[model samples]
Target chain A: MATGDIPQGGDTIAVIGGGLIGTSWSALFMAHGYDVVLQEPAKAAWPAVPERIATALRQIAELAPDLPAAGQLRLTTSLEDAVEKAVWVQENAPENVPLKRAIYAAVEAAAPAGAMIASSTSSLVWSELSAAMGDPARLITAHPFNPPHLMPLVELFGPDPDRLETAAAFYRGLGRTPVFLQREAVGHIANRLSSALWREAVSMVAEGIASVENIDAALVHGPGLRWSVVGAHMAYHLGGGSGGIGHYLSHLGPSQERRWQDLGNPALDRATQDKLISGVGAEARGRGIDELEAARDRALIAAQLALSGQRP
Target chain B: MATGDIPQGGDTIAVIGGGLIGTSWSALFMAHGYDVVLQEPAKAAWPAVPERIATALRQIAELAPDLPAAGQLRLTTSLEDAVEKAVWVQENAPENVPLKRAIYAAVEAAAPAGAMIASSTSSLVWSELSAAMGDPARLITAHPFNPPHLMPLVELFGPDPDRLETAAAFYRGLGRTPVFLQREAVGHIANRLSSALWREAVSMVAEGIASVENIDAALVHGPGLRWSVVGAHMAYHLGGGSGGIGHYLSHLGPSQERRWQDLGNPALDRATQDKLISGVGAEARGRGIDELEAARDRALIAAQLALSGQRP
Candidate 1:
């Protein structure tokens, strides 16, 4: 199957590091018919990669079943061997700067000159990740939300505009949503927004405004549902009554600003931490971790399907 | 069908100020087999009430098909007639303080002694709404998300704990999820969290970190999906592996705090408003308001069904 940017038969992709992110990326790449070469130095982690990849593939099948059959999976311990014939290298090594630098240095030596190098780092900026690279033009930040194969967002940002475009095209070819950041920012787009919202949520609990259960319920039933379809901007756009966002700004924006000023910024002190821990326990309702995780996954898949109009 | 708190069959419910919120409340009450009396002073709005109720009931049927067949709907221009025999009164008057006070005063004089008078005001606190009432015990805040029949959250906050419990039971009887606030706060539980998140989202777009389209996609594809299933606290709890939220706080709480500090507090000034308007126009791709609204309603209903495991 021909796809954007890739060759008619698809390209050979190197997935360095066989942890959760690495395995999920490998599954997505292979499911889209890209030959995946996964390298893990830790012998113990290598055995788990295929199992995790299989689980991820099952999920991808449910969310996007029309894609072509998966390509072959090649496992290797040698980083040099993994990148020998690859067209793209997705580095998911440990978050340590020094460790990432060493891995990139090794990839630069062995991978083809035209191969685009992307880092799945959530914390570090592109400049920091590509500092040690001899040719940093090809290195870009392509951060994905957790469970990469399911979540469609792959936030991309970097200096080289051409490589960034190529990275975006590559991700799009794999049936993913690639959002390009105009510049570097801490926590990128999603995490920054998530952290901001969570801070206020934590403050609400700490201040005795509402219980943790009610907070979560309030979100899931209210803005969270609307957000799944239209997002914040468009939600406001519709709120403006056909005049669009400009009307909303002139009328309701002041109320939003007032709420922001009143929003809490509570510290994660010992007292707050205990409150949150106990609150979550009560909300969990005796459900085990595995049960809750499965429920979340099912709910996420259901949401994706519903948004796509695949289900009634 | 007998349900909690109400009479053996169903209680006579009054829906005052038949605007959007009142009509929605009427549809929800009628669908749950409760006799509903809806009051609207504006005669022009009365003609459209039936059509709006029919639309809302259709959506409700899809989301909660187990609900009993709808009871009768009675529309009236007289506030006295509407609340005369009601066992519960949901006041949905416009957000004007004086108008709400007058409506409550009339409701207080006409409604049955045991009737629970609740305000569906999103902005005003319980005290402010009940300030003009002689008996404020039954006058509580029972704010529901827009399209009340579809969205399950009914935020209940009031000075009377027993009445709040009764309100919760009544909403639960209607197959709605009622979240009880420990105390009164502006915007209640959901809107406050929503405003906090949107403030950051707007700041990101205004600062040029990303485009409006990308910001919306970042949320709908990222945290929005997770939020549909679990709230922020549980999300962090799961992120902590087996140790729960305490471990997450001990390890990653500092990073969250740092991200919070970096979050933007952007004002909705004129320039920012223009940028957002054009951004939304570009994202809309020429879809009209009615089309977009229908799409939102469909997606919301699908998400509700998916979460309840009613869909494959």
Candidate 2:
């Protein structure tokens, strides 16, 4: 892919896999003036992908009124066509290792030697997946939070140093901040933290410590907002000095340690599992999956725009 | 002391700790039509407290546009006078158990016999602190989040169940949702989850897994927003049919155990502690203790009001 294949002043990206993440990648790439070519499995996913991308763009427009004219985005059905001569190929496919291995092999075979093949896989080990490719060094995980168009984070990881750097630069080009999981860890960063919290929440509910609504209320009404901005470390950092986290830990650390020890490791017992399923199913009562997912996409776009200081 | 002396439809609250929480409690009581007499030992804490309280009240007013009236909040120097004749004593004293024990004993002796003495201690066991009061049962931990006026969560716990219920009702009357923490725990619901995440973030930073800004960005841009609405459990619940805690655990539980084992358990070593302190201090460089606290209080008030549908 030559610099000319890229838009005159802006970059061009080819997002392979026009599913949920693929659509988001397209919108984000296009929003930044990247001519995007999204490859889907068949004609079946074509219409839905555009609709999803369009809805997100509309939201991006709403959240950021000053956003630049979005780049041109098109959909395709051929992987070879999408990757041929493309500056960047962001593969958003099934997270299965075997499947990723296959797709990456093809991506490596079809794309120009210089084109970066970025995987949007949230959990697969980068080295293992990329090793199957001819130039394993070219593949890097540019894992965006769900609804890539909105969320500002992109967890980048790969065994190869140059590949990781290129992937990071590409994401930055799209106004997305790429966070390197310097080491490949399961669930990467955010999901791992979330999984821990969710485990505790489920245990609390299963143990009858508090109702589901009460727990949700506790968070949304408490640190959720603060965490949204400064995060736990920074929040605690501020919380410690001036008597922030440090003050808290010193005064309350021992107590926290004691509690930590007592927090009975509530494994997923059959009863607890039932409690969680029932509890969550009840919570999701009326919302349609498609609608909820669309809403998530919009929220993500708004969040991304907010972080980037761009028009959503 | 009869319920009549408790003041029908009205009462005064002596807030004996004029820190961030004390001021917020003052605003909350004042907003609900109760006169508040806030007492802080540090005379230096005087000027800033009132200014912060005023700012918080303005935000409270904006959120709860129909808030009763303004003149309900007052500051005082006499701790004895603050508690005298008051129906409720909200002790925002430091987290030190001995200090709280001493304050509780004094406040318990000072306030009307029927009055409730509530501690805002986040981690201290209630039974230990309550043991010091004249009517130990009257004491309870009404742990409010930072900027209590804004955040509506109050983790209520006590040695006595009846008293716990009464305290819960009292907080509910003040427009705060009190979740009964089954027993004393570190960080309570929200903070515990926060601590776990912060610990992970620290480990990640220590390991160079990601940058400070990128981790924070991931949260605010992703789960943070979702958490602000439905929170962790509900989020995983909607992750898929086989999602939520049960499915997550069954599918990824071993992985969680693996990750937990892989997680760095760095002690609060002197160097690391200082690193945290300096890092956070750098982030909060320009904002003084008072200013940052006030800003936090105001934002909390707005958020709390928004959660409770009281925000204008």
10 residues in a row with least lDDT, candidate 1 chain A: A1-10
Task: Report the lDDT tens digits of candidate 2 across residue range A259-282.
Answer: 555443466667777776676556
Indicate which candidate wins on DockQ: 1
Chain B TM-scores, listed for every candidate in order, come to: 0.95, 0.85
Candidate 1: residue B197 Cα off by (Å): 0.6
Give per-residue CA lDDT, model 1, range A1-312, as digits (tens): 111144323678999999989999999999989899999998988778888899889998998889898988999999999999888889999888999888889998998877778899998898888887898877889999987888888999988776777777778877778998998888899998889889889999999999998898888878777777778888878777767777778888888888889999899999998899899999999987777876777778877887774211
Local lDDT at A234 for model 2 = 61
Q: What is the lDDT of residue B5 in candidate 2?
A: 36
DockQ of each: 0.62, 0.39
lDDT (0 to 1) per candidate: 0.84, 0.68
> Best lDDT goes to which candidate?
1
Count of clashes, each model: 0, 17
